[model samples]
Target: MRRPHGVLRTADVEHGHDLLPPTPPTTVGVIEAVATGSPRRVVDQRANAARVADLFADPAQRQRIPRIYQKTRIDTRHLAIDPLEPEFLEFSRKPATIRERMNLFFEHAVPLAVDVARRAVENLADPAEEIGQLIFVTSTGFIAPGVDVAVVKQLALSPTVNRMIVNFMGCAAAMNGIRTAVDYVRAHPDKKSMVLCIEVSSVNAVFDDDVNDVITHSLFGDGCGAVVIGANQVHQPLAAGSVVIRDSFSHLFDDAEDGIVLGVKDTAITCELATSLPDYIYQGVDPVVSQVLARNGLDKAAVDLWAIHPGGPRIIEESARSLGIPPEAAAPSWDVLAEHGNMLSVSLIFVLERMIRDTRSAAPISTGVAFSFAPGVTLEGIVFDVIRS
Candidate 1:
């Protein structure tokens, strides 16, 4: 059956409350630049796949777990600091019990973040006055004078520029940043916004031999992605196929907080990701997307592009299967995962930037959906249409 347009038939929200206002006719431009701190080293996936097999040589783990890990298609990952080195490992084990690992993590993470933010702003042709807001998203590390303050100092954005800092939310937090910027543009159509996401996933490493922790250690990489979004007046024209923001929807699953969590224990940060994540996505996303489309008076078939967070191979596959999206629709996401592992919140934007660059053909109106999952078992989605020049 064909689904109704972007209206809500679901029980979550009643019909009378004020819906978010439509995106203004004003155009928003996006500039994406990525920076990494990993040593100039690369990991070969073919060899790592063999190593994984050898490590989990036990019968059951070898059979069931290795198959799932192999599906991630991650050949090798880059680390801010090598994980195999004795000094790093020793630091992970004990650091005089006085110097906390969180402090050490922040020391390495903040500078990289500042550098990426500067590059993104510097790449823009417009003067600093053109950017009205700056939003920073990160879950990897925290410092007193955070990215918001750091970015302002480094980029020299105007003192009047609005600033927001979002912390602790995991991989999907970037969607929240985009949603905030979209709302900012809608309210003040002439204003521009910048979003910077930096995640030093290596810092959060648990240094444990547990299978789940090992899997996480192997899957995440350290990277930062920064983008500028706002009126195009002072910036380069958005490329021919750039994705434009239209609308967004967010849903938090009930009683599922325990399913995914990131927290600090002793001097190390630990991530607890339940194996049931695939099941959560399978159960919730279909209805959520349907409701989002219904509100915009759009049907599922109307969506022409999909930019899903490359959380992992199984999560991506489950999302595709649940949404009935073709493999081609999610190819960019897969490519991001293969090339960069999960850079937490930055991964979605990385994939979206690629889609915007690759799309060429035109239709009446093309809609793209970007979705991500994180702690709180939250599923956030944004729907945007291509703006013709």
Candidate 2:
């Protein structure tokens, strides 16, 4: 029998390889690696948007929601809770209590966090036991011991591993998580760190006729993103190849707090999103790019790829306009939003993860600039250098 073309034996799998393509030889540099976890549920935007619009109880708002959902550029998303589930959907008939919402948060977020955390660790080809610290980021819910403890237990990291939580930080929480981990690794170069972001935006669903609730339902989704950064004294691979954290920067638009908001009321997370978000985001991100680039003695032209947060389609356009870059530069952000509606803190990291892979095998891998926004009108940015062999 003729052997299959280039068939290889599947035995000694002990070699140092990861999910990502290995870096070419003659160059060993640090890299930042990431992975994503599957959401518990999937939702179709066009259909769910219509259903959520009906919950408005007002025909005017119902008619308006479709246009808004269509304009969002999101066709689908993964949700932690089913929108059509009787328990969650009966909000108009009987509003969901805080306890019920919190229940969904715990039930869904715990396992989701564990899965994403594991994927992150597995991607590194580094042992999980060596992770010096665990950082958890979430804006959708709160707990006493919080999601960090559960994540460590499931991931089986050091029981004594340092734990930190970046909660209620909104979409930018993942950046803060990475920033915290980077700070730790900088101090303890021998140690590695993991940052996990899990958002269950569906659990925060509001069942009332409020315009904000309808808008929130139409916009947000659920999922988790995890990353492992090399902080050792020597440059370590954050992923399979040579991707290093060149720099990261964040800024807050003064008096712009009113633009986006997340709050808790009677158990479920409450949202206060402004319609003028695109204008605000465009205005906010331009300076952030300049500030981050200038500090590194670089400019917009030096960036080969962009991990822009797709807070929305309009926001993506605004981000591109703000940076004065071509519309294609922000294409990846829009792609993420289209494939999966904004997953809050989990959203931007997804964009970055793909950029990391794209850099590995495609153009625009080097000098990647990542950007995401959170409440407090905060703009978080990070720069990555994919040093290929």
Candidate 3:
């Protein structure tokens, strides 16, 4: 069966009243710079691929699991906490509770987010000044004031700086955060806005025998990605080769919400990576891409870069095939996934940082498209016009 490319089937939209709603384009802001940081602890799956499989001790259950972790294409990932640390080794006697896990999130997320944010703003003329707004995005853990407060306090940002948190929005949350930052910059053109996507997927790991839990465990690592967006004409101009927000769009999968699940359990968060996830990405990519491009008055040929989220290998593969994006266009995303696993809410921003920082991308890269999927069975797309320095 051949899947339709570059067009949304009418059938999918009929079931949902709000499949795609185009938002009026926001004022353009330059993506001054991009940066991403990890927790300094690295794990090479290649070395431990077999040993980690031992996490699943039931032989009958183990036989059904693929030792390759589905050939995740992931080579190495960094974690805030080494899963095999002596303390965690006695898991049966004392598995980590949600409270203990959140404690780790607060400890690790702040410095990681602050470092990436400082790196982004360091590109400015004065360096790290003039940032008046902070938008923090993460899905793995929760704190009352949110990590945004921590980012500001550590950076010594102006106490009056506006703060907003995009919580539990999953992988694509960064793109949504970027959109909101664009709105903030547009509304307050004199100010600079910083967006941080910090995901501590390492701490979210559950020590369980469930096959789904095992699969999810193999695909997560801890990391933070940040970008600074400012008015093009501001005192500290965006660095050259910065991506400008051309437009943004949001869409849903009609009835595919069940395909990706992240739910809160009594003592921990549980996730179910349903088999149809690839299908959900496949079905949603065309419409989301088509509509976003169309609304921006862009054609398929305009995009020289594709910043699609690397949710998984299959998600990336099916997306490129469906959207007619060249294999090379998705390589950064593949590399990020292979190197970082999926950092939950922080994953897509890492993809964007790769696109922005690639020296090969050079300058005057006119147009680009970024796509990411979330548990809404939601898809958000952002179109960018890269201005060379």
Candidate 4:
């Protein structure tokens, strides 16, 4: 395949080694900095449940709502809309059409994306114009010229910066985006790149008595996360405790495409969660993690930390059990879940940011693995090490 116009080929740079195979790039990608942005409104589970309870007229369902919300173990979430507001309550009862939902998405998603991207860039040692690639990931919204373009224009990123948009991949999109960044930096070690994940689940809210809808509503919150990555060759002396992406792994559970369904309907965006998803995650995480570790000549015990996506309380617990790690090892995932709920593709990045900060004072070298699940019952894993400066 032809390289893009400005991306240099090794052959072009090494004048005397024409007959030899190209050497590997001498730099690894480092996660320079990470930043997160949330909607201004903080929605407490009790008030959220109370507002949701009004939507279900049945006394029995109303009684079940609070119990279901409590079971999620999410105390508060950052929602783009206030659940207790009369206007939002009215909209929940009479759901908006798909067009209206998309409008809500456009109005809120771009500004959040730009804000998070700005923060991530601010943490970088390089200027904003030095960012050569921009990847925007979201499962909750779509637009032509999309959030990527808005981010570029708003952040004053290079006009010629490479751009990618990953849409509708659900929770796993963030890992995939990071992997894409790793690939980019490995190929173009001189360039810096960024991955921005923003999900406005509140805009796609589904108000229904269905248990799946109730669980989905209880678990997701609106938020955006951004990570700035660049080859170590370009950004030497990145912030202390910056993580280097060592390797990545991905797997799709056989015949499990229907495990989590996210689609759009005339009434609103729709989400259907399978009851067996926790079981799927429990059975699959071990193999994906084992293979990645084994390939890297390490094992589970060698890892100092884990950034398991907090898809839900059960998902986190079962994943820890499968990995044979103590519950506290997955505490970052649990804490993020309780504070922010699931922000879809953005949740794992939030966990990553927290782990990097909390472990800043640890030993000189710390190994960590991150995992995220999406609609395919897919698992995306990354092996990384934090090196203190």
Candidate 5:
């Protein structure tokens, strides 16, 4: 059965109060690395923006309007070296080399993922033995034992460390992973859980030379982000600064599953994104946001921080406009998109990490709303408070 919102709320009272054992503070630590194999061949947004426009202007794809292809302020996109190199045209032109392609892709992807996970975990002073759980999230590549195993092998974490893999959920899966960690930390307030969100989207590219493929190719880049959540009671100086996970809420739009989907066909994965996506978010997101805030006894005006997924430029604009979020409130999201094309599941976490890192003063009883939309037409939402240590 689907759980109703606000069925429970813990961690509300002051730290030393008798209502509950002091809730262990949960904080986010981020580490991000650009994939080495994916070279930035085309490093300008305007040029790519024009390429994006031309791709959708084809007569056969006239129905796929260019307007829906939001003008990404993406100055550059990373591409795998062999794929982008002129000499690789022979390999690119071929079809039906699935096993060979998969092998090549994983070889490059795994190392970058390991590097990203290692760097991120190293940011936390807690020894590997103390990390009781490792949650790995990704949609672009698949491998047995996966990132969880890779992290365990590299970090020398306990063999008993609880491991979970959240896969194929698209951009919103990152929140799902975080929500899972939140529940774990809430249940075991003495344990620490690490979340590693890595997306090597460039590897999943389909070279169909079609409009849908072009848009997908142009909009995504390679990136990975890792975060750590721990119980607040242990209280190891609170990391000097951290964003506390006060509460989180998720809402899924059941009727709109066809609005966005990512699926595999033959040797390539296709991203089927409807042009009406902006309309869907604009029409649906407000009520969900309202319901989520109301359940927390918050009004629209009470939310001071919004770490929304930068799905694209139009999605971001429409979401902000639909939800009545101010321009300043959406600035960080826009900045992320301009600097790095959407990294799918990992993008929202990156935004949240930035907010936590950049806070210089005590943030208002700040309510951060991080959300993203994807297949199943999911609207994954997470709300948290930024507490000053």
Candidate 6:
């Protein structure tokens, strides 16, 4: 007699029983596609160093410019405004006010966002109507209705699209945006969501003699990146080269509140980065990652790709060493830093895009983890499996 449905026979179990076939890993959602864009102007490190040197009248601050910038390991960056332009020069000579900077942000942020958003949604089954939610993340600037409203208008996104703007979260904001998107798509598996990260760091330039100001000026660049996320159902199969997001982890370190501070000064936004920030990350990363892997029933050996944020040279280096990730696994982070400087929250998406694209030609990255740091000395990560086919 045949075994009953949903039942297994004792003799079959005692013998070699192939009761059921293996099932695919369940996922919150898949990263369907990614698109990135930058402003027209390109600023190489040498030119940027000269520009920084020009802003400082003090001998001490001016002397530290080269070494500080060189240590950042950035080669070229894109900026919204040309440093030599009259408006930029005027602002540098006499720093732009908060109002002026916000105006610049409003101008550049929307267009860049629209461009990348359009590219991101082009391959969707219904580019305009399919997106059920829009999550926008930015740290450099903000507006009343913000970039999300403009994106809906410009990209012709669904008028009723649910919108959330993640502002002032600093470098690790993208993970928050992705987390939000994942939650939405998982709940509404039939609809898709988008995470847009735009940082026009140039608009927040601080032309001051302070060493922290110089360090901030040297490391950041302008960029916009977007990722479309959706469920892996038959009606909306995972995109080619897409990665199925398995799980995410977020942690906030105690007594590290001041590790990174973004102050809204009268002149413009100012950033204070603690010298010990890397040490905090080094000590904190292992546990956060181990927890992420453990929850997913995995370990370091199971992770084949790592997409750690390049906060600067040291942040990425320390993060990799702490996680026991090989140098080559961290190369994409360093490459993005060198090519685009640190685009704040937008940078990690670039690293993810690079890794996903690289899989096309070379060996596919099967399992991967992406993580980043933020102001609260916060650590965020996502575990995923590459769908190379």
Best by TM-score: 4
Candidate 3 stretches greater than 4 Å from native = 1-27, 60-66, 89-96, 125-129, 233-239, 361-363
What lDDT score is found at residue 346 in candidate 5?
Answer: 74
Each candidate structure's count of clashing pairs: 12, 7, 0, 0, 4, 0
Worst 10 residues of 5 by lDDT: 29-38
List TM-scores for all candidates, in order. Answer: 0.81, 0.86, 0.87, 0.89, 0.80, 0.89
lDDT of 5 at 159: 88
The list of candidate 1 runs beyond 4 A from truth reads: 1-41, 45-69, 95-100, 123-126, 231-241, 359-365
TM-score winner between candidates 1 and 6: 6
Per-residue C-alpha lDDT of model 2 across residues 1-389, encoded as one tens digit per residue:
88573343443234523344544333221335677976856788899877767666768887898998898889889887686677656752354477777767888889878877776777544455578888888888887676888887777777889888888888788878877777777767677878888888787776555666666777888889888765533443343444677776888887888888878777478777786777788777888788788977899898888888777777778888899988788777888898888888888878876765663455424787887888888888678776554
Q: Report the candidate with higher lDDT, 2 versus 5.
A: 2
Residue 356 of model 6, lDDT score:
86
Model 6: which ten-residue window has the lowest total lDDT?
18-27
When summed lDDT is taken over every stretch of 10 residues in candidate 1, the lowest stretch is: 30-39
- Global CA lDDT computed for model 5: 0.67
Cα RMSD, model 3 = 8.7
lDDT of each: 0.71, 0.75, 0.77, 0.83, 0.67, 0.84
Model 5 agreement with the true structure over 254-344: per-residue lDDT tens digits: 5777778887655655577787787888888889988888876887888878887886887788888889876567777877777777778
| Model 5: lDDT of residue 43 | 45
How big is the RMSD of model 5?
6.9
Better of 3 and 5 by TM-score: 3
- Evaluated at residue 86, the lDDT of candidate 2 is 73
